[model samples]
Target chain A: MQVEGLSINLATIREQCGFAEAVDVCLKHGITAIAPWRDQVAAIGLDEAARIVHSNGLKLTGLCRGGFFPAADALGREKALDDNRRAIDEAAALGADCLVLVVGGLPDGSKDIDRARRMVEEGIAAVLPHARAAQVPLAIEPLHPMYAADRACVNTLGQALDICEALGAGVGVAIDVYHVWWDPDLAKQIARAGRMKAILAHHICDWLVPTKDMLTDRGMMGDGVIDLKGIRGMIEAAGFLGAQEVEIFSADNWWKRPAEEVIATCVERFRSCC
Target chain B: MQVEGLSINLATIREQCGFAEAVDVCLKHGITAIAPWRDQVAAIGLDEAARIVHSNGLKLTGLCRGGFFPAADALGREKALDDNRRAIDEAAALGADCLVLVVGGLPDGSKDIDRARRMVEEGIAAVLPHARAAQVPLAIEPLHPMYAADRACVNTLGQALDICEALGAGVGVAIDVYHVWWDPDLAKQIARAGRMKAILAHHICDWLVPTKDMLTDRGMMGDGVIDLKGIRGMIEAAGFLGAQEVEIFSADNWWKRPAEEVIATCVERFRSCC
Candidate 1:
């Protein structure tokens, strides 16, 4: 009873399970594809994690993640690049589809987002050679504008596409529903991403009204206002029928639930809502 | 000295004082321009509010606000239009430059934002005749993307401008720095807004990092990451020499302060930062 086209990003269950248990839950529920964060992989040991993923014949939709490109100084940026190179190596080992990037925002006490954006581009360019060499595609995840000051400065799919166009190759975009569902130009940009062949991953989570917390209050598929099926249809039309990776970061609600229950709910919601 | 080009949106001191006291405080500080919410005006009684403004020769930058078009049924929509018509009359009475529109979000149990946006446009179109007769312009204030679901579906200047272009004369936009400072196309859109002569109001408030509350925690002009002077430069270059209205919605901080202190601070900040 393999769910034909669904994937679970491990962050959806990060509080309840680690890398290995998450995979086990996904497998138990017929979800064979998973995306795991770097810390989770590191905690379980990359070699052991890779062995488990391979032995189970699991699809690693993406490795989450590697991009905090902006830094206050050149030395700090070099550190970030070195870490990203390590992440690429890990992605290569896991045979993950792509390395998802949450590109950094403003440096300490600086108001210059343009400079921060430039830094993100340059950081990605610096790592392009290594990522390409590792056969890993870099997927820039454009975060919502609310996170513009503290998190990813890359805040739109079109902006991400512009970056991808600037850098020759080995770069793409991860279309996350929570970050981009409200975009007026969503269909146009998703289509543009399709034409550019840059839609490396698709992530799902609803945007709850009265979104209680700015960062950790993501909703499950059907509980909020996002037109999940509609967006999935758009993505499918755009030529990427990849798994819709579920990534929820709900602190007060979903995170408190048992891992099994969470996975079960994800499966149910995916079938019924998403 | 009278601060040459500054306006006070009364919401900044909403928690501390009501309409008349707020106006007195503004006049005492030499800020003769103000934007008052309908509730504030109703509390003071519109006739008295109008008298105060007339006697003091105050400029009504805008009346805050009108537009909540999306409703669950036809009756609800008609009610919204009726309310918007009343708001138009109030703006006319106050000699306000425009009636700001915080266009409504999706209706209850409905995730159809396109329908909601269409409702907003239709609502505006329905009210345009009344607004024109009353001699009050309509200023569509494009809210931040975070408010797209509950507060406003119109989340970008470009989107608002598109509506204005479609609606034709007596319709424009209120460019709030807090709402639109993060836009990658902000400069270009502001320029476009200027080209169309659609820039009606320029609201100033910094976007604080770690914005504690999405609705109320806006920063002062010099406090946050928004390039206030730069944005002001853009607005001015776009031929909008109108007052830069101070509109901070700080629940725990600014609202708790005395009205005098807030007005004084606004005057000082408008000179130094904005």
Candidate 2:
């Protein structure tokens, strides 16, 4: 009864359940692979979280995020690198496939995106050695351009791949359909990601037409305008046969639903829609 | 004294005034150029609007849009083309430099952005003869990626330039800072636009950090994080010495202010910020 190629990023159910309960629900629905946020792992204690994973023989698709390297001062940037090192350590402990990084945006009161982007590259490069030592591949999740100012300056897969190519190994990109489905060069960049062997993860979610909230209005797989299946085909064609991780941030609808209903819906849609 | 190189897109004060009044306000503020929406032109009738433009010797930087090419059916597609032809006529009558095209998003129930983009290209090609004859350049304004689903599928300067290149001449692009500022490849594309001589219009506006509304809520110049002078420098260096058309659609803030105040603020910002 296990779903063959699906993973649930725990943020999809962050509002409805903690790390343990979210896993229980995913398991009940035959979804054995999961990606948990660092906070989620921390909440349950990393040791306990690891214990649960080992006991269930669960596959950790990825550890939910570590980036946000850009800051106003040198000290602040160093602090961010220190934090990333810790995140890599946690991902190493969890046996996660990769550590997803939502690389930070502009420092407070700054408009220099180029500088911020340079900072992101530098921060990633600084942590590359530690991440390599820990065997946690750093996955740079290029956020949507709307989030370019406040969230992640890395806004395109091509841009992320450029960083990966620049920094050398121990760095790849997390291809989230929500952030990149609008890209005209999506297929080309995706193929490039495959060529560079820089695609570390594949995240799935639909983009709502009248996306109500910029941050939390992500749609479930089948609900919105994204050609999820088309994107998945492109990813598969690009030589990534990894689990299609579901990462919806629907505050108004899916997040309001019960954890069981959410997982059930994810499973149903993963079959019928995604 | 007239604000030498600034043009007011009437949509900036759209909520505050109609065609005649908006023109009067701009004239009073010593702003000699304006870009009015098609509806605003129609409100006072094109003849009267043209009279005002001629009498005051005002320049039309560009007309406020004509695209929305993708439709659900062939009939709908034809209807869009017919409408675009009419928009060309309006731009010609108004003596606008270009007819800015928002270029439609996905048709009803269609998730294929590639097809929608094709439809946009086809739609433009279908209307090109009329536009060329009318001598009104078609300026494809690559909207913000956030509007890629509902507003414009052409979401990058490079993508717009590609369309322009493929479609041949009589078509260029409206390089709106709000949309293209987030592009990682912005400076390079702007230079490419310059090299191609495909830079038809230069629209100016800021991107508010916590952009409240997707359609409206555009920050005034100097209000948000967009590096205005930097982008302007790029465009200017690219050999585009055209007016910086101030196009803000702030629903809650600027839209609620007096037309005179908004025009004055635009002039002030044009000098100080842009």
Candidate 3:
């Protein structure tokens, strides 16, 4: 009953369980693959988290994040780079497929998105060597345009692929359905990414019709109007045969449910909708 | 002192005033140009609205909207087309520059964005002859990515331009700063639009950092983090010399203000930020 090529990003059950408990829930549901956020790993202590992950023979699809490059000052930028290096190390320790990056947005009190974008590229370049040294590929997750101003300025698969091309190897893209479902150039970009061999990860989540919040009102699969299976087909056709990581950040609804119920819903939705 | 090359989309003060009062406020502030929604026009009666525009020699920058093409059935599609024709007639009656189209998203209970997009294109195509006969150009306003699910599937300038190219003449794009500020391909697409002469309108609004609501949490020009002057410069450079229409949908903030105050602030923002 193992669900091969299916991974659960712990954020889906963030409100219901901690890192260890979330993993246990995933295991019980025959989902051996998982992606954990840095905070989740830190909560359990990275050493214990790594021990548990290793002992369970679980597939670490990806580490939750390692980017926030844009900053108001050079010192802040250096701090972000240092943090990214550490994130790469953590991903390496966990034997993750890649260190996914939610590249930072405009620095506080700044209006120049172009400058922020340049900072993102530079930050990625600065950390590329460290990531490569740790044998961890940096996966740039281009967030939805909604998050471009405050979360991640890298807002398109094409833009992320451009960054990957500029940085050469050791860099690629994390194709998240929630972030990119609206892209008019989606099929073209996926084809381009395939040609460049730059697709690193495929994350899944539904976009609610009435998305209540800008940050955390993510819909679980089958609950919203996303063509989840269609997007997966596109990603698969683009040469990424990796796990489809379910990563919902629903604060009001799904997050309040029990961990077992949440996992069960995810499994059912994965089978039916996705 | 009239602010040249600036227009106010009346939705900015929709919560405070009707069409006639809003027009009076704009005239008082020496902003001769305005774009009113269909509801606002209906409130005052189209004949009165047209008479006011003619008497005051006011410039109707563009009509608020005329698209929501996707439907659950053929009857819905036909109804949408008929409505679009009416919108075109209204725009022509007002002597507006174009009929702005906020192309509809997925049909109810459906996850097929591609089909929705096709419906939009087909809907526009169906209405093109009527628009042409009415002497009203159709301006496809690519809404923000957040609205792609329920409001609009066309979410980028390039995508809008593609539709324009396919549809031939009497069709173009409304480059809204709020919707497209985050697009990395913006400059390239604007330049491409210019080459094709597909740039019909330039809408302006700030994207607040913490956008509270997906539909109505738009920010005023200087209050938010958008590079208004920067984007305006891009559009101007791309040969679009139309009025920079201020279109904010701030339900909690600006909407609560006096209509005159909102118009005055829009004038000030246009001079300073834009």
> Can you give the TM-score per candidate against the true fold?
0.99, 0.99, 0.98
Q: Candidate 3's residue-wise lDDT over A110-138, tens digit each?
A: 99999999999999999998988989999
Worst 10 residues of 2 chain A by lDDT: A205-214
Report the Cα lDDT for candidate 1: 0.93
Ranking by lDDT: 2, 1, 3
Error of 3 at A22 (Å): 1.4
Per-prediction count of colliding residue pairs? 0, 1, 0
Model 3 misplaced regions, further than 4 Å = none
Clashing pairs in model 2, backbone N/Cα/C closer than 3 A: A68-A104
Model 3 lDDT per residue over B1-274, tens place: 7778989999999889888888888988999999999999999999999999999999988998999999999999999999999999999999999999999999999988998999999999999999999989999999889999889999999889899999999999998889999888888999999998888899998988788888889988998899888888888898989899999999898999898888888888888888
What value does the lDDT take at residue A22 in candidate 3? 92
Runs in model 1 with CA error above 4 Å? none
Displacement of residue A76 (Cα, Å) in model 3 is 0.7
lDDT tens readout by residue for model 1, A1-274: 8997899999999999999999999999999999999999999999999999999999999999999989999999999999999999999999999999999899988888889999999999999999999999999999999999999999999999999999978999999999998899999999999998899999998999779899999999999999999999998899998999999999999999999999999999999998
Residue A269, candidate 3: how far off, in angstroms?
Answer: 1.3
